[model samples]
Target chain A: MPTSLAPVSIDELKAIAKRIRAHIVEMVYEAQSGHPGGSLSAVELGVALYWNHLRVDPANPDDPDRDRFILSKGHATPFYYAVLAERGYFSTELLKGFRKLGSPLQGHPSMKALPGVEMSGGSLGQGLSFAIGHALAGRLEGREFRCWVMLGDGELNEGQVWEAAMAVPHFGLGERVIALVDRNGIQNDGFADQIMRTNPPAMFAGFGWKVIECDGHDMAAVDAALAEAERPDERPRVVVAHTVKGKGVSFMENNPGFHGKAPTREQVELALTEIAEGLA
Target chain B: MTQAASAAATREAYPYALIELVEQGVDVVAIDADLSVSTMGYQFGEKYPERWYTVGVAEQNMVGIAAGLAACGKTAFIASFAVFLPGRCFDQLRTSVAQPRGGLNVKCVASHGGITVGEDGMSAQAIEDLALATSLVPFDVVVPADFESAKQAIVAVGKTTRPAYVRTGRPKVPAVYGPDYRFELGKATVLRTGTDVTLVACGVMVRAALEAAELLAGEGVSARVLDMATVKPVDRESVIAAARETGAVVTAEEHQTTGGLGTAVARVLAETVPVPMSFVGVDRYGTSGKWDELLTYFDLTPARVAAAAREAISRKR
Candidate 1:
C-alpha cells in the first residue's frame, strides 16, 4: 500500500524524493507563507519516515492502533502538512489555505485543529514527555503501535527536554519510542553551536539509547537508520540526522535568518525555480 | 482515642479508596516525589505496581509527567508534601493541567498543610500551600477537615472533571462524617449558628473553629462557624449570608492570610456587604518541634481563633 519502496532501488527513492520536494515547494509557494527553510531541511527525513517506517491510515487518522508521530519542533510543520496532503489524508487544495484566517493550520501544529497531529507543539521540549505518556499507555494497555517524535536540535537547550530524555530510557520504553533529532545546528537566534552547543547523540547514548548517525539529506541513509531503530531492545534509539538549516535551496542553505521567514512573492518564484530545477 | 475497634485514619484509607478508580475501568496512576509513605500513595503504588511511578524526589517532573499522563487519558495523582507539589510544580500545573481541554483531571493530594507537618521545620511545612493552589485556572481546592471528609475529597477529585487539589493533615483526627457521608465540591456546611460573628475555616483548622465558636459563646459573642471546605469556586452565597446576618467575621485556615479563606471571605464581603474581618492562620513558617509546639508557634489554636473573632466583633462597631 506504501508503493513498496523496500525492494525498489536508490534511483526510485530519489524520484519519489523529488515528487515530495515538489509538493513541499508548491504548497509553500501557493500559500505564499510558511517556514520553507526548516521544511526543506526535513524533506528527506519526511520521505524516509512517512513513505517507509510509520504504519498509518490516511482514512482513519485517529486509529489508536496506528503508530503515533509527534513533531515537537513545529516550525517544519509545512513539510508534514504537505506529506499528509499528498498522502491523501486531506485534499491537496487545502494546503493553499495554510496559516490563513480560520484555517486548520495555525502556523503551529495544534492537535485540537489538525487531525494527524498527536500533540500541540509550538512551544518546544514538551511533546517528548507526551510521547512517553502515549508510549507508556500503549505498553500498559498491550497495544502494538510505536511512538516517534521528531525533535529540533535547538530545542535540546530546554530543561524539560533533558527531563524527557532522562525519563524515556529510564522507563526502557522499547521500540515503542524512536526519537529523531534533526541536528541542523540552528536555532531562532543563530547557529546553535554559537548560541548553545548541544551534544545530542552522546547525551542520548549516555542515557542508554542506541545511537545512529545519518545524512538527513540522503533519503536512503535516513531509511537505513530508521530501520535499525526497529530492533526490540532495552535501549531507546536516537537517529541523529545531520542536516543543513535550509537544505534544498542554494541561497537559503545554512542561513539561520530563514528560520521562521516566509518567502516574498519574488523570492517564492525564485525558490520554486531552484527546487524544480534541482528535482529535474 | 480508640478502645476496641480501630479504624485506619483517613490518610491510611486514601490509597485503598484510590485503587477502586482503577477497578472501575479508569487508569488511576500515582506519582510520589519520595513521600509515598507519608502521602499514602505508597500503598497505592504497592497495590498497583504497573500504574504507579516514583518520580525520584523531583516534584517538578512528577507534575509534568502527571500532566503528560492526563493528556493521554490516564488520571494521575501527584501525592507529596503540600509545599512541593503546589509550590515546585506551580507553573507546570498552570500551563499543563489547568489549560487542557475537558480539564485534565490531574488530582493532587498534599499530605501536610500548615504547621501540622511539624518537626520538619519551615522547609517542610506548607503553610501557604492552600492559598497558592487556589489561584490556578478555576481549580477545585478541597481542604478536608476530618477523616470522612478526607476520603470523600480523594473520591470527589477523581469524579470531578476539573483540576483539583486536596490538602490533608498528617495527624489522625476525629472522623467528621459517617461511613456513607457524601461531600459536595463548593458547598459549605454550617457547623453551628449564631448572630454576632461568623468564623470560616477549613482543613484541620475547622475543628478548632467549632471549638472557638463554643468559647465565643461563653464570652457573650454568639459566633456562626462555617466550614469553607472548597476554597476556589467558594461558597459565596453562604459567606455573604453569614456576613449579612453577623456583622463581624473571622476566617481561619491552615494557610497564609494572602489567598486562603480569609481573602476569599473578604472579597465576597467587600462586594456584597462590607463586614469587619480578622484572619487566624500561620503568618510565618514553623521550626522543627513537637506538633503542638509547631501549631503554637504559628498561633493556629482555638484560643487564637476566638481572640480573632472577638477582635473582629470589636472592629465591626
Candidate 2:
C-alpha cells in the first residue's frame, strides 16, 4: 500500500492541512451551516500562504511589522480559520465552536471579535485596497514584510476589482505585494462563465501585472509560484490557481449546489470515509 | 469695510500645505476622480511626481486604493470632490478603513465640503461628508478654517493613528486662525466667548460664526464663538458649558441640518440640559453660482447666523 496520498510533501504540514479540513467538515456539520465548496477549494491556498509565506506570530499578532494578508473573498474563512487554528494562532478546539454565539470565529471575519484578523470582511472587491494600505505602511517604515491578498474568481465580475487592478502597477509595488485568484469558476448563482466571464490572468496582464498560472490542488506547484513571487521584481505578481470548487471528496466535486450548503451527519461520515480512503 | 477686507485678505492654502508635506518626504499619495484641478489634488501630483498617485477617475477605487496603501502603513492623502469620496465610497471606507482597528493613516482631503462648492452645483457639493465620516467607528473628523490650519491639520493627520478626514473648500474664506495656529483631532477651540449665546461652527462657517458673534456684540448681545473643528469626537465638555452658561446655541455650517453641526449641538444640549438651539446651514439644494453667491444662497452668512441666534434666544424664554 502507498504510504501517503495528500499533495503536500512534509508529513507534518500535510497532517496540518488534513486536520484543518477535518475541522472545517466538523464545524460545518455541527453548525448545520457554512460554505464548504469554496472553503474546500481554497484549503491548499490558505495553508500554503499561512504555513510558508505569511510571517504571522500567533504569539504577538499585534506586531505592527507582520506581513499582512487580506481574504478579499472573505466567505472562505472556514478554510482560513482551520489553518489559523492548526498554526496555533488560536485553539484547534475552537474550530467546533464555529458560527456559535460569541465565538471569536464568526460566520464572517470580524476585526472587533477576533485577534489577528486584520479586517472584518465578507464583502468583495474591497480587501485589495486594504492590502494596498498595509503595503504602503510597510514601505513607510522600510519594513520588509510583503502584503498578500486572496480573491475568488467570481469576484472578478465586480468592476471595483479592476479599479484596484489598474492602480497596482502605477504605485510601483510590483514586488511588495502578491494577489492570488482562487480560479474556481463557480460562484453563488451559477458557473462563472454562465454568470460572468473573465480571464483573470490575461486581465491582470492587461493591467500590467506579472501573471503566473498553477494547479491549485498541487502543493508543489502552488509553493513554487509563491516562492517565485518573492523574487526581486518590479511587477506585482498574480497567481491564477485553477482550483476545483469542492476538492478531495467525491459527491461535492464541481457541484454548484454545494456553494453555501453544509453536509449533514450521514454525508459528513461519507465524506470522512471518502477522504480517509484518499489518504490511504 | 470689515467684511469686505476679510473676503479679499483670505487665501486658499490646502494645495500648498499638501506640497509642503510632499517636500518633507511624507510619502503623501494624492488621488483625484478625474477632477484633479477642481479638487486641487492635481497640483500636489504635479509638484510631487514620485509621491503623487492620480488613480484616474474611479472615486470608489481611489478610496479603496488609498485604504490599501494605508493598510500597508503608508500615509495616503486622498483628494476628491466631497460628493464622491464620502458619497460614493461609503462602503469602502466603512468596511475597509474605519471598521479595522488600525486602518492605514489614510486622510480624506475632501474638497468642496458643504454647499460652498459652486457651479458644479448641488450634486458636487458634499454637504454630508462630515456627518457620514463622523458616524463611523475609529474615524476623526477635522474642518479647518484657513490655509495655515489646513497645513497643520495634514501634518497632524500623519502623527495620529486613526483614520481622519480634513475637510476643506473651493472658496477662499476668511482665516479665523493665523499662520502659527495649532489644531488637534476631537478638540474644540474657543475662538471668541460671550454670555448671551454660543456660536459653534466648523469649516467655512467658522469665520461666518465669528462675524455673526461680532455683529451680535454690536447689538448688545454677547456671543461665545467656538471652532468645533473636530466634529466626531466632539468636545462634549466645552459644548455643554456653552449651552449651560449661554442658555442658547447657534450652529453654523455649510451643510444640511440632519447630520451636520446643528444635530451634533442639539444632541449635546439634550443630554446635558435641554436648551434652545438653532442651526444655520443649507436646508435645501444650492444653485450653480459663484462660490460667495452659493455660500450666501445657503444662508451661511454672518448676518443670517446673527438672525438665527437672535431668533433662538427669543424662543429660550
By DockQ, the best candidate is 2
lDDT of 1 by residue, B251-303 (tens): 99888888888888899989989989998887775689876677677788889
Q: What is the DockQ of each candidate?
A: 0.33, 0.52
Error of 1 at A202 (Å): 1.0
What TM-score would each prediction reach against the true structure? 0.86, 0.87
Candidate 1, residue A108: lDDT? 74
TM-score of chain B of each: 0.93, 0.91
For model 2, fnat equals: 0.74
Taken in order, the candidates have interface RMSDs of: 2.5, 2.4
Candidate 2 lDDT for residue A191: 93
The global C-alpha lDDT for each of the candidates, from Candidate 1 onward, is 0.78, 0.77
The lowest-lDDT stretch of 10 consecutive residues in candidate 1 chain B is B1-10
Q: Highest lDDT among the candidates is held by which one?
A: 1
Q: Which stretches of candidate 1 lie over 4 Å from their true place?
A: A1-40, A74-104, A249-252, A260-265, B1-13, B23-25, B178-180, B269-274, B283-286, B315-317
